[model samples]
Target: MHDFLVDLLICPKCYGELDWQIEQRSLNHIEKGEARCQVCHTSYPVQDGIGYFLLPDSGREDLWQEVDSHLVQHLQQNPEIEKRLMGVPLETLSPADQFFRAMVHEEREEFELAEESQSVANSGIYTDAYLSCWQSQTKYLMDRLASNDKPLIDLASGRGYLVEKLAQNHDFPIVATDFSPKVMRRNRRWFEYLGISDRVSLLAFDATKMPFKDASLEIMTSNLGLPNIKGPSELLHELRRVLAGRFMSITHFYPVDDNQNRELLRQANLETMLVRDLASAAFEQSGLQVEFTNICLSLAEPTPVGVVLEGAGIDALPVAETNLEWCLLEAQQSSKAKH
Candidate 1:
């Protein structure tokens, strides 16, 4: 669920209060219920666990129906996964981790699926888009290196996309760490496939409790990876403790806005010296100084018509879209002088 939906729990059209119906859980059957708008008497269907406030028989019904059907089917197929996901304390988990777990649950069935099945190779839809976006960011970072020999670390690096890209051009030692052994194994396979197994090292480490000494790292990068981090504040402190020079992270706008984001950082006692946008912010809050901040537009191209048609095997194509975007950020970090 996006932040917008979380905040606005009422029906958009009728301005009615909505409630969750737990009994009628089947996807195939349209769950009968009503969201009575207190003011407008506009009753909306609470079908398939989603509260639809829009006009009945509107163009959006099909879309909402599909989404509700998918949700119901998924929950039914994987009750254990659903229970585990729903059991997480939303307020306690970092916004990033909450979002990460949501994505992981949606895709991987609570990380119980085999690594090979969940690997990028199996998901052409995600692989193409993810590779394109990260490749652009990696090339941009490479341009900034400018003959400098700095050891780089990728925290929570799943499948090692950025590390693999960096190894292709730079000879610097790159370490990719994640908590999942299954993910790390897949990452190692990618490294081997690219013939850069020796250049990149894969380690199993928790984001909150990194296995590195103080002032050991020059550059640290987490690409939309840290949000799935539990105890984000502690994780930030750990990142600061390990970094000798700089730390850069790309995250999402969850728990929405800078205030909530900063609250988490401050709780960890991090001093965010610079903030670029809702998507990214740089913390010199740990007594570090910011050297540079770059915000670039990163985009992913849509699957070509031929590929989509071939994959779907449908000449009658529905309106299709891609997950392209322009929200990319990079920050440079350095140590600050003590008073």
Candidate 2:
């Protein structure tokens, strides 16, 4: 467990700080310790290294018993299959390992996509057009925030497409960051291509743990990134923690389907304003006060049925022209909150 996670724990009876004691030699069993509240004289027992802060007679035992049964069943499953399927070393796996594995898988897929795009760029076929498309998209977003004069932070800023575009029009410093080093190198190339290598700084940073002081940045934005994140709430909290002026995130807004996604939004508790109700709910969510929201419709020819079927490997029918709706959201972070 992280040292910061200790902030989440408190005495259940007296709501005071309970001393963390390591009873066993193993780190996994360190939670097994008797906790006595200094204020209320209430003692909580530790069973199997899990501290039960609730009273012994409390009705919460049924919930904990169900959780314990589920864990036992999970442990009974095949270790090798669990390792291959979940990318976890089942024997040493803890709750933190499970969360980290999920994030690793998500990042692996994103890196694969970035590699494919780089391959296409190196093919020398439509390279100019591909780069132009990225440049245009970046410009479109930057133009909307023309009035803001603060430094910009691009979260999950793969290849620095947005950063380079902003550099072309504005002189403000740009911090381009991504979890993958491959993407950060791509971003460096973008700066070199734009002749603004000195203006943009690239860093490998996890969005959940932003490396910035509180209220250090004026603007924060992410394009086609947040949806791929597993810990959206943590990312949002970090964004709010570092942003000094405004926070903006552009993402593919899919409807909540599972408990994980539901819990993510619940933890963030962000005040969201949707631009336009698209078929797929493509909208931007901002923690700041939304000043404007607009929708832009673009038309493109659909992919061929054979290519679609081969790529997705699911279903194929017919190809037709379709309209795609993109949302543009602008908001300002309130100065009142230091979060």
Candidate 3:
């Protein structure tokens, strides 16, 4: 991580200022160090150029872990399956199979191949409208990102798709944050391979309790990350506390009348983060004025989870097929914002 980042950070656990002691540095990047909070005495480590700032008691569920674990075990037991699958042309594979193929590419550090596999899988699965809007949304973020020279932190930067695009397309510093250390490590290698490591840094931190100093950040962005955060009741408040500028997020909402998916979203207790009106209200309750803009509706069908072995497909959540309204969330401090 950059030395400049130390000034922007505080202890996420206690919000106390930290004392950074660097043990190793490569010019501007600190590859090894410990950032200890002066008040609470919580020591966070900087490893492999990514700062580990997650809370000790973080109870977040990692869907990636499940997939990786099952895939690893499946490949070990059925050794020939990997060769058989890899030998097939990517075009002939099902979207579900393509998804697993991408996983394999990722393991081998074949970044471009993994992305190619993902593109094929996504094209086969999601509706045309879904792909169009996703492309447009990414383009929109890339355009907006060019205006700011200051650093940007992409929250919940799983798999690093949005962040990669931003880094490649824009001329701004980016700090990609996720709760998963494994994801961060993967991103470090991937970004290095892409030759964009200098412009990007990695941090493993929970979004609800960010490591940023209070009101110190000018901009924060996320691509479809908001609704996935656990315990968002306090999250909005926490975001407002730390942001002096704005938080721009790309999110999609399922129709409340879409009985199958709507009930599923509500049961997950993510109504405030998904439903447009509910999201706005929740932001206002947290003392941030919010607006939903650039809205577009798209239809999405369920994507089949492919098997690594017989009957052991990656069982991921939210397989609901339905229509969705994609939009950008603009949230900033309100004049009426209460401390």
Local distance difference test values of all predictions, in order:
0.48, 0.47, 0.82
Query: How do the residues 1-339 of candidate 1 rate in per-residue lDDT, one tens digit apiece?
Result: 111222223444443454433345333322344545555555555433333344443332242321333434655687775555445554343333343334445343343322322343223433354555545655666676657576677877876656766788888767677765445555555565568766665554466655455566677777667555565456666666666666665432222233644465446533222223322333445444533333333223233222211232211211233232322344333324333
The candidate that wins on lDDT is 3
Models sorted by lDDT, best on top: 3, 1, 2
For candidate 3, list the clashing residue pairs, or say none. Answer: none
TM-score of 2: 0.46
Q: What TM-score goes with each of the models? A: 0.46, 0.46, 0.93
| Residues 51-142 of candidate 2: C-alpha lDDT, one tens digit per residue | 34444343323312322223224434656534443542433333233333333333334444333333432323223433344345566677
Worst 10 residues of 2 by lDDT: 308-317
- Per-residue lDDT, model 1, residue 207, is 65
lDDT tens digits, residues 1-339, model 3? 877899999999989999989999987888999999999999898988989998878864442242354665677677798765677899877777887888888877888899899888888767799989888888876776677888888888988888889888887788899998888888999999889898888999988888888898888889988887887777887898889897999888878777777677778887888787788888888899988777888888766655433443542334577778888888899988744
The alpha-carbon lDDT assigned to residue 205 of candidate 2 equals 48
Which candidate, 1 or 2, has the higher TM-score? Answer: 1
The segments of candidate 1 whose C-alpha lies over 4 angstroms from its true place after superposition are: 1-135, 250-282, 290-292, 297-339
Of the candidates numbered 2 and 3, which has the greater lDDT value?
3
